[model samples]
Target chain A: MSQHYRTLTANSSSYFVLVLALTALALFGLAAAHYMESEGHWITGMNNQIVWGLPHVFAISLILSASGALNVASMASLFGKTEYSAWSRFSGLLAISLLMGGLLVLVLDLGRPDRLIVAITHYNFKSIFAWNIFLYTGFIVLVAIYLWFLFERKMNQYVKVAGLFAFGWRFILTAGTGSIFGFIVARQFYHSAMMIPLFIVLSLSLGTSVFILVTQIVGRLSGSFMKQEISFSLLRLLGLLLALEGFLICAFYLTGLYSAARYDVVLFVLINGGIYTFLFWAGQIVIGTVVPLGLIFLAKAQLNSSIRLVSATVSKMIGSFCLLYVMVIAGQSYPQLMFPGKQIRSTFFDGVVVHYAPSWPELALGMGGVAVVGIIILVVTRVLPFLPVEEQRAQSSQ
Target chain B: MSGSSENLGSVDLKRRKFMVTMVASMAGAGFNLVELAMAKTSLEAESKLVRWGLLIDTEKCGVGCNACVSACNTEHNLEDHGRPETDAQWIRKLDLVDEQTSHVHSLPMLCQHCEHPPCVDVCPTGASFRRDDGIVLVDKHTCIGCRYCMIACPYKARSFIHENLTNQRSWSPRGKGVVESCTFCTHRVDTGRIPACVEACHAEGGGAMTFGDMVNPESEISHRLKSEPSRQIREDLKLNTGVRYQNV
Candidate 1:
């Protein structure tokens, strides 16, 4: 069946309000970043030990989600799922915007954001960070080209090849992101090959959830409805991806438990690690994985579709944050075991669990990134024919 | 007999003339023999043959000695920001107690100056680099303050400059939003002086630190390393660190 697409009229006052609100939020985030830069990171929760904190969680999640968001386009073009092609343009747009938001957060959180030009110009081939700089930029370029092919009628034939390339690049991009943690030989929490797959599956799960929520909101705004068949299929896909994410998380912990060297940290995170432990069991496993899975499968016959969708997506998003909090923050919270059999004490808080309480500025900066993504999606859908319109509506309008 | 005596006298006169010529040339060049040797040694500091290293006898390191730490601060002019957790600690004293035995040992920890330094390997900008003379240093000009090097260091040897720095010593240039660590007092080392921490340790602390060329067999560091039992903190990483420790 041929798919129809439509753009929002954008004349509504609510549209302007949303635009204004998102712009304000984005500005607030920028202001927060400026405050941190001027006042220094000491004002934030991060210390010398806990170098990466809340902003990293937001940035990494968004970046990981960006790659996952592209799965729709990849499915339609690369996997020959023609039904998914209708939503591919929207998917591509979301992917780029999400990446932009993530990259912005990562850059701003840097000690010297002004030297971004140096990061671009200078290349340390050995460094995974340097590699990611290329991977991230190349992803945007490739996705843009893919979107171009999807938008232009004459170039539609080459969309498949572009989709294939984008799919491969996203995989590599996620791996590069994962390797940023995995390559660190110093820390016990990371430095595993498992990070690559874990992050890849997480992106798939989180990105799909974002896609569903945003599409639903866009549908309400545009007065377009998705066919029940398509909605159910996406839900099933989400359930499957969530299961994969859950499985990987279990495997990651089990592997860590198996290693005597990593056992202490694993125990710390799982049992005694106060916030980290609670987040792992309650936030990540139950809310992120278990509840979402239950809502999709167990409650399918009993609950309303909108309730189920909202509940599962929201749970997944919350769970993702919790997991990242544990991964990024808790990972560093456990001190590096520099001396194997010796307990160390120093003025620098060595051999001690470093506690980090993220300040307001950190939260603002993170939320700013989220708002930027929101604004990008809202504006693009209004200006461009991104929202998928129903066949009947398409016929009636024309 | 008269001719033979005359020949002997000529030979003696020739020998005296040669000795005088040598002394006159040395004086003309304005360099005493000792000063010439010192200049050659100074030039060799830039060469890879001179691997600067430190050997710390943890046994001799006093438990409460803050001399080395204070000296490093004074040397670098690391301002007291009132936040010790976020301050730059180029070198700090570590008190280690064996988990099984509960025997306590004290020693100072700083940048290990590894042969295959992970910080240099992971640095995106090549700002965290190891000099030819086996000293690892962060180039202030190129360091974009990513702090990946800090994360990569196993010893937790690095610190990020948390706030905007002022009143920094001209020799030790520090700024905000950049990573800094123990430079092994490269400024002093360049001018034929040991690191302030080593000097202070010798003068006020336990005299535990011995600084010398690791490559030179005749150097005290090389001799101690050979004669005494010294080991790197994380020898399993095979980083070949320039810093070595004795006892527990």
Candidate 2:
């Protein structure tokens, strides 16, 4: 019992250190945002052609993460998966945190953050962005209430019903996110009907991986064991989902190439030819998906205890990072207009017809948003009995 | 049966008389307003023909003289910044190349004054709107610095004044943070003067741009369209743009 307490203390210290680092980074970002607002969007690297930059990418990633987290929590609570019940509360808390973080980044990205309320009041029913405002707000509220019921209140049949409602709505909310890009017929790369389903699948994979990583890290710190059955099941689920995601990405590129859409094909070439290609193929694919799957397979095949745990932990982290990177690139790479003859050349950056590199200030604000997520997760874990306290005690005594 | 037939006849007669009176009165009112408005302008055309549009010949547009650009800046009081992309340009010449074939083509680009303008549709405050005469304009008074119009515009004709601009007339509404685009030189059109760009193009030998009332059968723009083949940019979009290009 003393050894377990010591382990918890050490883990808490590390989490605290991480939280502190993220907070400092966020403050720097806030300062940059203030300066940007005082001045204008001109302070950033964005130009006429590349109006959106890194902040937009980060915001989209956060939204994806939030949606994904909600999916995992729903699988346990709404689907009546008793094995996943232990991690449901933590997942719910993370979902709300990521959603809030996503919204913050999105608001900061806007040239006129002061006019945010106007976006809500003035709705274009035809525009997907207008719908997203409502969907995202509703999703956050549902998740918050769901988490509250799990952690603060006694879990009841009503809570399960609410969980089911949240789980169902999140799919539409994520679909709405995809439609924001998918509806633009002008952009050939994003005009496909497959984007909505792709977003949902990616959200599931990313959401599950993040939940797993957070659980493992927290368990390791507190010297509490997550049920081995739940951990293995999640790992296996993630492996299969990732494998499908990888296959779909290949099919997407092949169709783009075969279609011979000149401007649209350029997006693929830019990602594959430049620094982004390495990030895509190496960081996103190999480190994030392939190696992680291999490690999980080895662990399941009765590999050494130390190796299995280390690989599982590494795999989760890499998967989360990969999911984030893919979303960012996808949002940024596609130009505003994708018509073949009607191309507007950008003059903002040199050495290309049109180029986009996120400014330092944008990056800082994005990092700050990431920090906010960490802080929220940390606070929630501390206040609520995120772990099954009774189960832990019984196991320790045995 | 006879009584009912007689009643129906009386009702039909009354309706016909009412319709005639209403049509006559509306036409009278419309004519009076037009006369009153035209009386205020000294250079008003005798025929009351106004709201000029341009027919640009993309093939004949020379890359040499930027006379249209210079005239637009002088008339609009636009800053003489070297970077035309950042600075406002009511009219710009673009050199386009076919990505597959490397075939190059040059065309002078500006606002198309689309029949169904996306910018006007998306404006939350009705800052951007089309006038009755079919010219699209932005009222800077109601603009709230939100660049929704910029994103909605397919032609990318709109520009936002990012910094504080001076030398604007005290009565003039356009300023910083508001969107501005080519108005087809509405002020000059109201006074029966050709737009600065059209006049400049004419000075360089009327081969590039021809301006006149599109509705007038005898107008130069109408004559050019009849005599030569012309095409609108992004015709597939079905925006029904006022601006036409020749020899694309």
Candidate 3:
């Protein structure tokens, strides 16, 4: 056995602790899911006005992350870029995990989660959300098949083709998910034609960052020496994407602020007034994007050292978290009406303005989904050859 | 022998063409018959014309009384008066204003009962549906409480009961996690009685609230529309709302 493998196997206590923590989280998530099912959507803080809540935000995040992971695989296989191939298996696993997590969050968010199968079977082809169901299912299947071919069987051109398809389809799928909000012509905040493209770009950044962070953490825990160059390149790419996303976000807000529409004013309040303001400025922009970008840039300038590696990994995780936060708030902030000549003030609750907040049980269930994904990835990595064992063997032989 | 063979071939071809044409005509007739049968069955099933509707005249609406709102609550067994911010009002008197001139107008607003309701269009579970009689109602049994209907509604008429609600009588028939909205006092309308709000308004001698079938020319609502100068909340949107405001 390799020295690294020996070290990983020897650290039984840490592995046990991690397993216990993840298991506890999973159990909590299952309990929350059960409670939500029995109690109905009333368990969540979501009211009529604030219909979409934390679960929706988290689900969108998972989708973006899943898509981004596919991008990594695409670059490696289809683009004939060998640098990303090393992390392809890990990235593929993360994509599947994120998608599963997203689907769970969405199902739980449904008024009738049991009717999810009905949603898939009886599709409203005109509805973007209906199309998303098929896209997400297809994307998951493609990723699974590609992973099976890569890890279980020999790496062939066919697997690469499948990976390419998954990668390309994910972009369209993520854009379609964004179009759920985008196609709401009634909602001025989401009415802009740019939402689909914005979502695609945002997903690419968030998904890529998550892929890097997960792999780095896993590599550290499993005593696998992931190439520093590969990690750095990913961090650099993610930073660039984050910068572009930031620019778009700024442009979106500026356009809203200047527009002479009532909905625009409402959006402005959501962004600048109270909790959402802090969430946007601090959580989304500063901590999520700018700081992470700065960290990655500084680390890259300093070269491939331990500090650079740690900074890049941590920043990526934070950036991904921030992107999810923004998606959730942005999705719910806009009311679905043109209130120009109406007498209604459009408050959070009452009349047309129903109040909505995610309940504790709903939030716990969402968190539990994250835990389940982590556990799944951990188990899959252990049982299956997620990392290239052949590459390691070749290095040893050399 | 050659002549006999050619004649036989021609006869066979002609017979085949005639059979094909006959079958095609029969199939077309068969499809039309099936369509007619399906239409008849639908008509039989949906014979009951329950065109539930509401009419609000801003002219006679007493601004401070809010009797219509109170009556709706009493009849529907809704929670008592809540704070303006957290209130669940089926009927609301909106204080409208001209943004440029600072001119204010109080218009009582509720479910418009729109002809092309955006809410019904977006419902994923078909929980929010429009009746053949132009009444929009929710199926409590099928409602997963997704609240997509709430988001899609232009009037913002839909309200979600956030907490666990009980003791809700059949008159209202709302529970926790299901979206509730102004059903034009469907239970009352189903009987001979007008909506609670309309009755309350009439009792107050304001005559602002009118309840009748818009489709029926003989209906009081149609007569009022012809006699009185009334306007919809957002007439520009062209929703063909059942509820109309007069003297705003």
Candidate 4:
């Protein structure tokens, strides 16, 4: 019976309420997307200067985290962490669900959402965006295969090969996502080779943090308990990855500031560029980087106690959100340089910072992407034998 | 009998020579006809023979000259819609001041139409493309409206049509969500006519802009380019833009 994992069984009333709430959130997101399509982009905060808006922030965050979710499974199978073997199926399932949620936001936000067929049919092979469509879809397929390898007892020996392939596939897939911005030669906030590695590490940290939060929440809901050893070990790894994320970000800025052409953007992001500066320092750094890192290591210092695990999870989630917000939205708000040294003036607001406040509908849509992930997790756990069978006891029967 | 046989042989040889020469001439005529047809098609089709470029003499450009802007608006029917904040600007005047010397100059800026355009490179659907003639344009039909091209454009030369577009110019069709920019007036160029902005600048004032074939070396723009030194905006990127500015 391959350890006899079971689908969760909840009270009908609670299940109904949960499904209904998730359905409502998903519907709201769909409605918002429809409105945006009908009303035109003028309704959104996005303009000529700031082409991407909250949608990108939401979608990219989910997408990156999806790739991150695979790491736990990869650890168990590929790296031979047998104890992690329990949560392995759940991790693969989480990755696919997160990825689909993220893709929903992206597709809905497209200017010609109607022309999605065109994006699929007609591709510029040179484009990173084109490469991403394949990367994203391929990721789903690969994860499914990995999950199958775990589910079928006879196919279990293929786990190592499948996990290894899946791990490498996700690394390249995420790098392709980062390279979407990295290839831009015009924008100061982008075009760094560091973005590729940054995305890879960011995906690991954010995805792992998300996986931890989801694991705990699902465990509480399903009345199952993850071993204390597994929980704390994952938390410690999260802390280390978060620290690595901060380090890589510093290296990115350091290299950028060295070049005069890129320095204006760096200064704007960190110091003087009004709202952008606040977001970077306060939203991303103080909340996302500093506090999460502090909470994680502080939790670690307590001899890896389970009581501190909650604080660690909360902080990492906050950090992940803040960093993503800074990278996606705030980054776009900063102006692109036309003339490096010229005092630029224009009616078009050249060389001036653009203000972007996401409308309510946009916020709803972003939440929708998050809610979509939740609903997927709920439904998947209900149907698939994703959870580890803790006991062959009477508790599981209830 | 021997004399008659010799006579018969000579007649047969003459007939064979005649047949060979006749077929050879017919084949030569068919070859010439095919050559003519190919030549005609080549002449009729658009050629990349001469790269169309612009030479803007910023020295002659006057301050507060809205002529080019107005002419472009009329040509493309760019609706102000009383929302300057959101209205699309195919071309706009830039006021540039030298940081070191405090020197100021006014010049129009739009799509540079680089030989190597970042917009075209980033577009997932090859909607944003450069014509063989060096004019960069957006194919609204194919555009999924991703707007990555807008982010990639260093000059901020692209604009997204935010409002549901109405009364779009027959010559310049635009739609909401589609990214558009100065097409260098491709329709006008096709008909052997100058762009509305260029014509306005010349007919009215600022005689600052020159549009012609830079590849010809004999064209007026090519002559002016050779006579005086001009520089491209953000020349460091080496995009090889069709648009050039003189004296910054």
DockQ of each: 0.57, 0.08, 0.17, 0.52
Q: Name the top TM-score candidate.
A: 1
Off by over 4 Å in 4: A12-14, A300-307, A391-398, B1-45
Q: Tens-digit lDDT track for model 2 on A1-398?
A: 21111123334567678768878887887888777777666667654544456776677777887888775578778777776676677778888888898888888766556767666666556556667888999998888788777755556556787798798888998898877655544345555566787777777777776666666666665655566666677777877877777776666556666665434544554465465556667766777777877877654666864356457646655554544454444433444442255433322211133455667988888888887887787666666566655335544664
Q: Write the per-residue lDDT of candidate 3 for residues A1-398, one digit (tens) a residue.
A: 32112123326677668877988987887787778666665556664556677877777777777888777788887888886776677778889898998888778766666666556555445546657778998999999888876765465547778887887888889888877776664456665556777888888887876777676667657756456566677777887888888788766667666666534544654554456556667777777777777787764565546566566556655655655555455445544443464434423332243334557777787787887788888777777666754334443453
DockQ of candidate 4 against the true complex: 0.52
Off by over 4 Å in 3: A1-11, A34-44, A114-123, A151-155, A266-271, A301-327, A330-359, A390-398, B1-53, B80-88, B97-104, B190-193, B223-230, B234-238
Error at A136, model 2, angstroms = 0.9
Error of 3 at A65 (Å): 1.4
What local lDDT does model 4 show for residue A132?
A: 96
Better of 2 and 3 by DockQ: 3
In candidate 4, what are the lDDT values of residues A196-311, reduced to their tens digit?
99999989988988888887777766765567668778878987887888899899889989988788778877888777678777766787777766776654565445446666
Candidate 1 C-alpha lDDT tens digits along B115-209: 99999999999999888899999988889888899889999999998898788799898888889999999887876789999999989988999
* Model 4 chain A worst lDDT run, 10 consecutive residues: A389-398
> What TM-score does candidate 2 reach?
0.78
Q: Considering lDDT, which of the candidate structures 2 and 3 is the better prediction for this target? A: 3
Model 3 steric clash pairs: A45-A357, A45-A358, A45-A359, A46-A357, A47-A356, A49-A354, A65-A207, A111-B144, B58-B246
In terms of lDDT, the poorest run of 10 residues in model 3 chain A is A1-10
* Candidate ranking (DockQ, best to worst): 1, 4, 3, 2
